[model samples]
Target: MIQLHSGSVMLQGGVPAPIPAAGSGRDKTMAYQILRRHHRGPWEGQLHLTFDSLISHDITYVGIIQTAKASGLREFPVPYVLTNCHNSLCAVGGTINEDDHAFGLSAAVKYGGNYVPANQAVIHQYAREMMAGCGRMILGSDSHTRYGALGTMGVGEGGPEIVKQLLRNTYDIAAPQVVLVWLTGTPPHGVGPHDVAIALCGAVYGNGFAKNKILEFAGPGVAHLPMDYRIGIDVMTTETACLSSIWQTDDAVAEYLTIHGRPEAYTRLAPEEGACYDAMISIDLSRLEPMAALPFHPSEAVTLRELLHDPGDYLRQVEQRAAEQFGGKATLSLTDQVVDGKLVVQQGIIAGCAGGMYDNIAEAAAILSGGDVGCGPFSLSVYPPSIPVNLELMQNGVQQALLEAGVLFKPCFCGPCFGAGDVPANNALSVRHTTRNFPSREGSKPGDGQLSGVLLMDARSIAATARNHGVVTSAAEVDYPAPAPVRRTFDGGVYGRRVYFGYGKARPEAPLHYGPNIAEWPAIPPLGEELLLQVASVLRDPVTTTDELIPSGETSSYRSNPLKLASFALSRRDPDYVPRARATQALEEARRSGAIPPELQSVQKALSIPDMGRVQIGSVLFANKPGDGSAREQAASCQRVLGGCANLCYEFATKRYRSNCVNWGMLPFTLAEGTDFPGCPGDFLYVPQVREKVTRGDEEFPALLLTDSGIHALTLYLKNTTAEERELLLTGCLMNHYAAQNAAENRR
Candidate 1:
């Protein structure tokens, strides 16, 4: 269904053709055109960009605003939207979730920002309806912040990046390569956008064909997709590990903006002739089949027909993979879900940004028009992306039809996508149309000896599975008439009536409301001359996601409080991580108090360090490739809160994760290619004159790996760090750097 071309390509006569050169035509691409408009610094090789707008949900906004406040933020420099979708549940922590909602509202009022109330709209949906504009760039604190289908380029990063935007600072990065996702042919009847997206992710994610590249969608197939169909596919681009995505805009896009009462936001955006792309992905949409991603990752894609053909084998693979992931802490039995040679799932969910769009829901309603989900353990639930979308479904009779078909309709929330709602029973399987099916997404604590699994499918296939009482049937096997396209109505009144719009009306005298659960960040010391790091956790997994570094479910409720949240760091993957890190932190505390602990005295004696005051003791984590999922800053911040000073990995799965580590003042260290990291917990890594090397912009560092066996030579790399990043490391973190700048300005 998808083909990847590694070499350069160019737009020749409105089609991708192999190009001999790759440099000059890059400026002609739609992505670079938008980048050129937003770029603030000199375009030597790196890009320093300032976005038109910024967005965050409750789980992230509190910490972002807090960081900005500590850095002497007076007012928001750009339009900021705060939505309470992820922490809207209020069931996990008593009064804490609601307190965060109150805090979000108060912050919006105090800082001249916009606030969308709980259950009103999810983050991306509100952005699509209100914030997206042609040629505009938006930065968000959520990883799935993609608006490319709307002719807007949306980039998702950690909260610190949003704080930078709030402080009027630029987002710094090397100019990323652009990949052309040239689509051809229309999709088949049963194939939905998720099918095409899953196929694309499976083809490119593993091979890194689209990694950190802006995917520019063009070609003949773009004309066939409706606005919502295009949006559904676009949001899933995050799974492919691409930096961002943009598409050629047409009348359909204009009509979407017009219907949303922002006709001025529409602008025809297309690549110029001879636009160069570093690589190209050719997707034949017509060849796509209804697909499902097995447990653990979106890249583990398989055709539903193939899965049903040999259900036992595929389910066994999932079981084995789960065993490897949990390492006997918990057991997942998907093979038991097979009955009579057919796979059976207990629950089905069509929710969140990818699956909650109008087109996916209306078609799912059509598929189940005359059918009903049987009265079995199996159940189906649907969450509309926004109240406006839910209103359209009600007006179109889609909601009522699905309601009568035994499909439960839920309010707008992102809980299902991140494991806060409709959690499956232990050992049960759930088929979902959400953005991810990662291990932690199942909402079960494997450390507690409880585990469940999720399989990602398109909404159409999920509806078909619901109709068959969760027999894991593909939509292609069921003959259903397509739903007639209805006129989309965006009721701006829903937002106007409830959402707090305070942009450009800063109330500087207003007080920020703080609850008991809310707390300030602790003081962080600056980098020392010498660094002593103890390996706290060693992960051999091919890729370690942010969810495993810091889990999502109940722990997310404590994101506003760093220490409480840090307690749950690596709780799911390694329950001993927090205690080990805390023990190391105690040693650091002793070092800060002008005394070296007996544990580190041996290292000081071996290294012949005369002055213990020049050394800093902290913890380190080693993984093959870490930071694969989520843009939550807590992944790195939680580690920092528990005295983590560095991360040793072969490579980072995404740029956002590496940025998070640097912004939080953790040394983002990488091993050379094919280098084996045999270090484990209790091992020591001693680096001399670390502060001088980081300030000098040195790329390589010689270190001693002090294992019980003896000292061994090791080399670590700190590559591609900008000057500002170096300052952040020297000052301890972004907050410290900003505070120092403000103090210097005061002195001046």
Candidate 2:
């Protein structure tokens, strides 16, 4: 269904070929055209970009505003939209969730930004409806912040990146290669966007075919896809590890913008003839089957037909993976879910940015029109992307149809996507049309012996599964009448009335509301001449997700409080990590007070440094490849808050996660390929003149690893760091770096 080409190719008459060009035609691509418009730096190896607008959800907006506030932010320079969707349910953490909401509103007012109230709309949905425009660039704090279907380029990064934009700083990056996602043939009936997306993910994710590249979608298949269909595929591109995505626009895109009451946002976008791409991904949409990404990850996809053909074989793999991921802390019994050679799921959800679009829900409602969900453990739920979309569904009777079919309606929230709502019972399997199916993302606590698994599917197949009473039926096999098309209308007033539109109208005198749980970041010391990194946690996992670094779900409520949230860092992955890091922190505290602990006296003697005052002691974690999944800054910030000094990894799973570590002043250290990190808890690495070497732009550092066995020499790499990043590391972090600059300006 998907073909990947690694070699550079040029587009000739809307088709890609290996035609050689005298010079690179990358600048002619639609991605570069939009990127050049937003580029603040000259065309070179690096791009310094400033976005047109910014967005964040409640889970991240609090910490972003706090970081920006600490950096002397007076007003938002761009249209900053703070949407309270992630914490809308407020089912956890008592008043803390609501307190964060109030703080978001107050911050919006104080900083002259827009605020979408709880249940009004999810973050990306609001951006799609009101913010996305042709040739515009948006930076959001959510990983799935993609609006390429509407001709806009969206990049999702950690909250620190958003804070940089809020402070009018450039988002610096090495120039990215653009990949052509050429589409052809129409999608088969009952095959939805998630199928194409899941297949695309499976083809590219494992091979790194699209890693850190911009996916420029074009070709004949573009015309066949509706706005939402393109969006559904574009949003899931994050799973492919791509930096961002953009698509060629057509009248359908123009009509979509017009429906959203923004006709001016429409503009034709296409790759110029002879435009070159670093790689190409050709997808035959007609060949797609109803797909499902099994437990744990979105890349673990298989056709429902194949899964059901041998349910036992497929389900046994999931059970084995669950056992491995949770380390027997919780038991996952998926093989038992197979009844009479058919897999049975307990729940179905069609929600979030990737799934909760008008067309997806409407099609699902049509499939379940006259069929009942049945009074069994199996249930179905639908969440509209926004109030406007919900109103349109009600006006068109789609909502009533789903209700009559026994499908429960949910608020316009993103809880299901991130494990805050619609969590299944232990051992229950759920098929969802959500952004991800990462383990524990469905609100299962393996540490507490509660586990559930989610299978990512399109709304159509999920509806068909619901219709069959959760027998895991594919929509393609079910003969259902197609729903008639309705003219989609948008009620802009729904947002105008409920959302706080305070952009460009800052009230500096307004009091900033602060909940008790909200706390400012603690003081972090600057990099010393010498460094002492104690290995606090060692993870042998091939890739450590951000969810494991700092869990989502209930822990989201404590985001505003750095220390409180830090307590949950590595809680799920390494339950003993917090205490180990705390112990290392205590050692640092003692050293800062001019008393070197006896535990490190031997190491101090080994380094032959009489004075340990120049050495700064902090904890470090070693992982094979860390920072996958969410773009939440907490993944890195939580480590920094707990006195983390550096991350030793073979590589990072995504660019955003590396940026998070740099922004939080963590030394993004890498080892030589095939280098084994045998260091464990209580072992230490000492680097002399570390601050000097880093500021001097040295890519490699020499350090001595001290273990009970003996002393070993090691080489650590810190590559591709910008000058600002070096300064941040020197001064501790972004906030400290900004504060120092502000102080210097005041003195001047």
What's each prediction's TM-score? 0.99, 0.99
After superposition, candidate 2 runs with Cα above 4 Å error: 20-23, 607-610
Say which candidate scores most in TM-score. 1
User: Against the true structure, candidate 1 has what lDDT?
Assistant: 0.92
Each model's number of backbone clashes? 0, 0
Model 1, span 124-236: residue lDDT tens:
99999999999999999999999999999999999999999999999999999999999999999889999988888899998888889999999999999999899999999
Q: lDDT per residue, candidate 2, 1-748, as tens digits?
A: 8998888899877678975541569999999999899989678878999999999999999999999999999999999999988987676898999999999999999989999999999888899999999999999999988888888999999998998899999999999999999999999989999999999999999888998999999989999998889999999999999999999999999999999899999889999998998888999998999999998889998998899899899888889877777789999998889888788999999998989999899999888888989999999999899999999999999999999999999999998988899999999999999998887888888888999989999999999999999999999998888889888899999888888999999999998899999999999788888899999999887789998899888888899899999999988788889999999999999998988778878778986765798889999999998988899999999999889999999999999999999999999999988997778888999888899999899999998898888888999999988888999899999999999999999999
Q: What TM-score does model 2 achieve against the real structure?
A: 0.99
Best by lDDT: 1
Q: In candidate 1, where is summed lDDT lowest over 10 consecutive residues?
A: 603-612
The lDDT of model 2 is: 0.91
Residue pairs in collision within model 1? none
